[model samples]
Target: MKLIDITNNHPKLVNEQLSNTDAQMVKVYSLGQTTVIYTIAPTHKDLVIINPKRPIRDNEIDYVLQRTIKAPLQSLEVTHVGNFVEITQSLKKKRPTFVPRFS
Candidate 1:
């Protein structure tokens, strides 16, 4: 999914779109090369968002999000969000962690 680079433009429109939908909670999934976000709103369809540019690293996630969403990550009241590595690890845990030993 191609994310329109709104860091330099259209920040207001994007904000309005998100706000109008009343989607405050979002679930995020990170594939190897990109990230996917699902906005949860009972009144509207879940908004699936990919990245705006290249895959954002954990260290720079805050900066990238601030630029793209035009709001500081802290102020977004974001909690219970999982990053790529975290989700991946959790998935791994749920699967059977056994190796076949053919004698």
Candidate 2:
């Protein structure tokens, strides 16, 4: 599936929404000491519903973490609904890999 790297300033509302839909918080990579890579679960069945004003439920967070650890790469699809944005996971083509060579 296509891997989409999440940005650092992706709005706390978005993150909160992810938490609501059971979006597991995977690996967090430090980038330039400011940015981080937050990987989530990859399952076609899993979905992350976003609500800007509403807070994420606790049970959803637990379910997300449980499923994320078991999956490989997480799939996320972003869509805007009203004033909220939904991030859902779906089956997509595998992402490409890049290897750097030393000079």
Candidate 3:
């Protein structure tokens, strides 16, 4: 039997793309050569599609979400395509309880 640890081997994101309009907003983060699209709808949950402009690992999806989204995700749904993956997470919007006052 052979086992491998692949959690720490994914590429890190170096840049991001933000698009905003009246209809909806889109956020795209690029990890090295791979690109992942993350969309959050006001009426629905957030969606993350890993189309992988290049090769991408599954754990990288988690990394992107952790870095981008401030809200904790709930009811996660992950779908694996031929060579990519899609992740859906319902975000509970919460107002920040603490506001720092810089003097």
Candidate 4:
């Protein structure tokens, strides 16, 4: 008989699409400084929808983006999240050329 070792793998995410029909409760990671919650969608899911605990203004896009992403994601323009052509096109259309800074 042959067996495999899955000890080093960390089950930090909730993969609903891949879960067996038996598992139920799961842990939520709260190590971030923002005190925000991130409910990761399952493996088959395409988005990590955020329903902020408090009200947020649409004009706060820049502030929210800056706080959410510590560094520029320029490198990902050709890969990763930007790899989706349709999404890139949509962002290009909705995004403004100049982004105003807030105090």
lDDT at 58 for candidate 2?
A: 41
Residues 1-103 of candidate 3 have per-residue lDDT tens digits of 1122222343232122223322144555556555555555654444444444544465666676576554443456767665576666554667769988999
Best candidate according to lDDT: 3
C-alpha displacement of 20 in model 4, angstroms? Answer: 9.6
lDDT of 1: 0.42
Q: Give candidate 2's whole-model lDDT.
A: 0.42
Q: What clash count goes with each model?
A: 0, 4, 0, 0
Per-model TM-score on C-alpha atoms? 0.27, 0.22, 0.49, 0.19
Give the best candidate by TM-score.
3
Instruction: Tell me how candidate 4 scores on lDDT.
Output: 0.27
Over 4 Å off, model 3: 1-23, 51-55, 70-74, 91-103
Task: Report the error of model 2 at residue 7, Å.
Answer: 15
lDDT of 1 at 22: 67
What are the per-residue Cα lDDT tens digits for candidate 4 across 1-103?
1112221242544455228522333322221221122222222112121223533223232233344323343422211222111001112224547988999
> Mind giving the per-residue lDDT tens digits that candidate 1 earns over 28-94?
4444345545454444323233445554455445443543445444444333333331111011124
Q: Which stretches of candidate 2 lie over 4 Å from their true place?
A: 1-18, 44-103
**Best-to-worst TM-score order:** 3, 1, 2, 4
* Alpha-carbon runs more than 4 Å astray in model 4: 1-61, 77-103
Clashing pairs in 1: none
